[model samples]
Target: MDLFPPDKILVDRVKNGDREAFTTLMERYQQKVFQTSMGFLHNQADAEDLTQEVFIKSYKSMKSFRGESSFGTWIYRITVNKAINQLRRNKLRAFAGLDAMKGEDSAADTNADAPLLRKEQKEQIKDALTKLNNAQKKVFVLFYYQELNLKEVAEVLELSPKATESLLFRARKNLQKELD
Candidate 1:
């Protein structure tokens, strides 16, 4: 059963000091936060922990949420920032433990297999994406995977639409080069 009618309803309830309403908001958005984190961190445990942190932080700051943007978008922005920070830390740690991260060991899923050229293509894409600079990767993921339009992407990234477009262009060029 749904704990609240909708996010807006819950947001109003939360603004009125209803903890349960806030919990509902967390429940509704947790998987999205986790997936967003995973797209950057690529580790289940870390992603899960970060998702939890994102909600906790959001809940604590709920009083300040003055409906500037939709609550969902605000939460998404928080999750992305948390994920980016983790990615930065991960890059630093990568140098310290070179052996463990090698060849599928640190990949998001250590599953069995998918088959054929599509699987190869998927792997290639993942590899290419990882090679992108952070700014380019951010635009690529937000635009391509999250399906945000250029304007929405700009809002999230705090970039001009033109800058976001250029980042995406460079990102795609880099990916295509890596794939070839």
Candidate 2:
């Protein structure tokens, strides 16, 4: 017998009020959801918080899941929406000067400068991602960070494969321009 049940079976169990089944589902996708959230927010704590939010929202709405797409795709859609909203909230806080009051952490880095360089590069990439349009950002994040193939990205974004490819191309071009 297979040690793991399929997601469809698990979804059915959850619909029947099996909380352990829902927990199993969460274990299956939590890391992917966290990576998706991190790709958008670029902050660990924010990503973790968003991951919890995604699972909570998923649990609440599991009954409404039409299974039109795969369970992973459905959860990814939720993560993307929540992460984007969080980014918008952060932007609003910055625009209102509230972010400034939070202040930066001044942890002493006794290590070498290599980590600093990598951190700077990571920040640059994050900024470049932010410059992308919403569609392009979604494509880039799903394809690269979440490691979804073009077809999977398309399914998540509800775009044709050709459209997803074009958006990905434009996103790469724009990101190259931004980084340069």
Candidate 3:
């Protein structure tokens, strides 16, 4: 009935400085962390870097593990925090592009007739996603891209499951509206 071998045993091994146990933990969760970060940041390179940072930070703080939550949950918290921070920084950069009107003009001219094509439709979807508010974007990414069930998304977002569902519903509705 145990999905994890034993948290206490693994924790003790890690505390006693067992590098292999740490590697096992990292291997088990690295992909999940990277996927979750990519869902938030929407960039492969940045997500990969954030995933490494999350594992390092988790390992450094593992000695304080009190067994109150699963190790998975603790690491998930770190991944979410780092990913959110990265997204905010990226948003700032995108907004700062407003200063370069010539750059915006050039992009618009290059894509002048793009809206008439299928490839442009995909680009429209990407643009609509970027337009979503932060909370809506977070809920949408977690629900869809991360493939988290509603309950897990609720836990990560610190919302009641009902509230999480509502958020997801709203996010989808907004995305649909934007795409339309």
Best by lDDT: 2
lDDT by residue for model 2 over 108-135, one digit each (tens)?
A: 1222354777767766776788889888
| Residue-wise C-alpha lDDT for candidate 3, range 40-93, written one tens digit per residue | 755566678999999899889988877777787778878877877876776677
Model 2 regions lying over 4 Å from their true place: 101-116
What lDDT does candidate 1 reach at residue 101? 51
- RMSD to the true structure for each prediction, in A, is 3.3, 2.6, 5.4
TM-score (C-alpha, index-matched) for candidate 1: 0.79
Per-residue lDDT tens digits of candidate 1, residues 105-146? 544354446555655666776677778998898887777657
**In model 2, what lDDT does residue 120 have?**
72
Q: What is the C-alpha lDDT of each candidate?
A: 0.79, 0.86, 0.76
**TM-score, cand. 2:** 0.90
CA lDDT for candidate 3:
0.76
Against the true structure, what is each candidate's TM-score?
0.79, 0.90, 0.77
Residue 140 of model 2, lDDT score = 91
Off by over 4 Å in 3: 1-4, 96-119
Query: What is the Cα-based lDDT of residue 170 in candidate 1?
Result: 97
